[model samples]
Target: MKNIVILISGGGSNMAAIARAAQKEAWQEKRGLRIAAVISNQADAPGLALAKNLGLSTDVLSHKSFDSREAFDAALMACIDQHAPALVVLAGFMRILTPGFVQHYAGRLINIHPSLLPAFTGLNTHQRAIDAGCRVAGATVHQVTAELDHGAILAQAAVPVLPGDTAQTLAARVLTQEHLIFPQAVRSFF
Candidate 1:
């Protein structure tokens, strides 16, 4: 069976969506896709508990414990390797991985960025979009690359930035689209 490992840092709504989709679609029996593990950099990450409830293995490798980004990434790589993941999915994983770590996973690594991408590459994307007076806001699932948020997009879902929308309201709508497209993008890996 092929293993898919998810890395998350927060509530992991995206990770939960993927797990739910895997179960609903019978990915294990149909595509030989199993969620081998869910790893978090923070021990208290809510997603870890969700993964546990779903019966998926979970681990935490706090970046704060490591002396440097490279050191932390090395340890993270080791943990991920233990699962022998065929694919590494980043669902709100906050760390900026080292170049070596990104290259290690390369084509097999993917991420779900909260903006249409190429537009808002880093944090505070929703607020930036709303400030810029954009008409559309959305999400993108793309192959992970050395450049932040600059990868070959595999899938995207666009939601209109409604009139008089605050950053919070816009983000909420985009998040809904994210839950829909991210799982589909993961399934496409098969």
Candidate 2:
């Protein structure tokens, strides 16, 4: 069976959704796909527990323990390689990967960004979009490249920015879409 390794740094809502879909669809038996493991840089990340509860294997390799970005990415890559993942999914994995790491995964690595690509490429994407007075904000599932969020788009879901919407509210709506599309994008590879 082909394995999928997911990386997360926060509350792994997207990770949970993908795992759930994998379970419901029986990807292993049906499509030769299995969510082999979920790895996080934060030991206290809530998603680790959630992943465990979902019957998925989980691990933590704290980034704080590493001396530099390259060191951390090297260790992270080691942990991920253990799973022999066919695809590496970044579900809220909040770290800037080194170019070597990105090149190692290449087409196999993918991420779900909170805003439309080529627009908002970094953190605080929701607030940035709001501050820019954008009428539409969305999520993009794309390849993970060295140049931050400037990867090839795989799938997208756009949400309307309602009147008087704060970043929190808009994020909530966008997250709902993220939960949907991220899984869809993962399943597409199989």
Candidate 3:
């Protein structure tokens, strides 16, 4: 089986979606994929409990405990290496990794971002889309690169920005798409 290690910093909605997919018999028989471990940068993150509930191995590598981003990434990489993951999926992982770490993972790492990247690269994506009066807002699943939200696109799901949509409403609509596409992207990796 192809082992996958997923990293998360928050609620891990995407991680849950992918794990659910990995549990399917057809997915396992056809893709030969399994979620081996879940690594979180915050010990208190709600995702950790969710992972445990799913019976997956989990770890916490709090960034605040480390002296530098390099230190955190190095330790994180060490934990990940133990799993011998064929693929690493960053699902709501909030850390900005150093170029060296990104390079080390290279094609093995992938991420799901909240917005159509290059358009809205960082946080507050839903508010930004609303402020810009964008007709469309969506999510992108892509290879993780050294640069933030700059990577090779794998798949995207777009949600139309309705006329009456608030940032919260738009975000809710987009999140649904995120859950769908994120799992599909991970499945593609295998």
Candidate 3 structure quality by residue, lDDT tens digits, 1-190:
8889999998988899988877864565777778889999999999999999988899998899889999988999999999998999999999888998898899999999889877899899999999999999999999989889999999999999999888899999999999999888888776
> How do the residues 1-190 of candidate 2 rate in per-residue lDDT, one tens digit apiece?
9999999999999999999999899898999999999999999999999999999999999989989999999999999999998999999999989999999999999999999887898999999999999999999999999999988999999999998999999999999999999999999966
Model 2 residue runs over 4 Å out of place are none
Extract clashing residue pairs from model 2: none
Candidate 3 ranges beyond 4 A from true positions: none
Q: Residue 188 error for model 3, in Å?
A: 1.0
Cα lDDT tens digits, model 1, 80-164, are: 9999999999999998888999999999999999899889999999999989999999999999998899889999999999889
User: Best to worst by TM-score, what's the order?
Assistant: 1, 2, 3
- For model 3, what is the alpha-carbon lDDT of residue 91? 95
TM-score of every model? Answer: 0.99, 0.98, 0.96
- Cα lDDT of candidate 1 equals 0.94
Clashes of 2: 0
Worst 10 residues of 3 by lDDT: 24-33
lDDT of 1 at 22: 98
